[model samples]
Target: MNDYAQYEKDCEAIRTTNQQLLTEFSAWLKTAGLAAGTIKNHCSNIAFYVNEFLLYEEAIEAKDGFTEVDAFLGYWFIKKAMWSSQASIKSNAASLKKFYTFLYEKGLIDKQALADLKEDIKDGMPLWLATLARYEDPDEEDVW
Candidate 1:
């Protein structure tokens, strides 16, 4: 009886659209057996993108709205500049490209927007975390 009740509850929870999709994606990722670190990285990147999208929506004062792809990238990535590190920003950009590509493939966005997002990343920006993580070469043992 308890097992059956639990199964019923799980089935009921799976009926919601967002829950169903999230469950399916999670199952797929689990079956794919990605490294734990990789899964964390991907999830973090996706969260960052979604957070920026929500911020963009709020900025426009739209009651119920999503930013066009251009406005999202331009304002979130180019204008506000919220990244703490170059590597982190690069990772987020790569994640956005993958995410928008998925959306475009699913017919959720126009192809032109994705195409316009393909500009080369500018190099030479020092990542703050990477700078902090640096340590003196172990062979050179002297330090004041």
Candidate 2:
């Protein structure tokens, strides 16, 4: 099989489970009384994080540890996404926090892993933005 064919196979393997978790995360947000727009944005953010980054790194579920989160926020998103900026970095970080909290409540990731992930965000955020600065136009609106 060609490379694209293998990639497609890998994607297909995770699709159902990925959709189920995202759908449940969406419902959980609704139940939390989040606004329609907020729920949409969070779910969209998580989907992109999972499907594009984590899954690309071979993560099949929300049970992964801090290394995955750090890599996504610190590197791949900026490298892969055209719209990346300080605001987007911050926004996706918030979304991932809430989404992972939900997964924690659902007993996907353990309490220790969640705590470490948050710590990873705190410690590594500066470096992530500095890396982003290399690619960002300082004069751009919302570049921060």
Candidate that scores best on TM-score: 2
Q: Put down candidate 1 lDDT per residue, 48-138, tens digits, no spaces.
A: 4454454433322111112343344433443355553446656655655555555566565576756655442222123322332332235
What lDDT would candidate 2 get against the real structure?
0.81
Spell out the clash pairs found in candidate 2.
Answer: none
Worst 10 residues of 1 by lDDT: 57-66
> Could you estimate the TM-score for every candidate?
0.45, 0.84
lDDT of 1: 0.45
Residues 1-144 of candidate 2 have per-residue lDDT tens digits of 987787778777666677898999999999999999999999988888877776674645555634587788788888789998999899898898898888889988889888888888888789889889965766665532
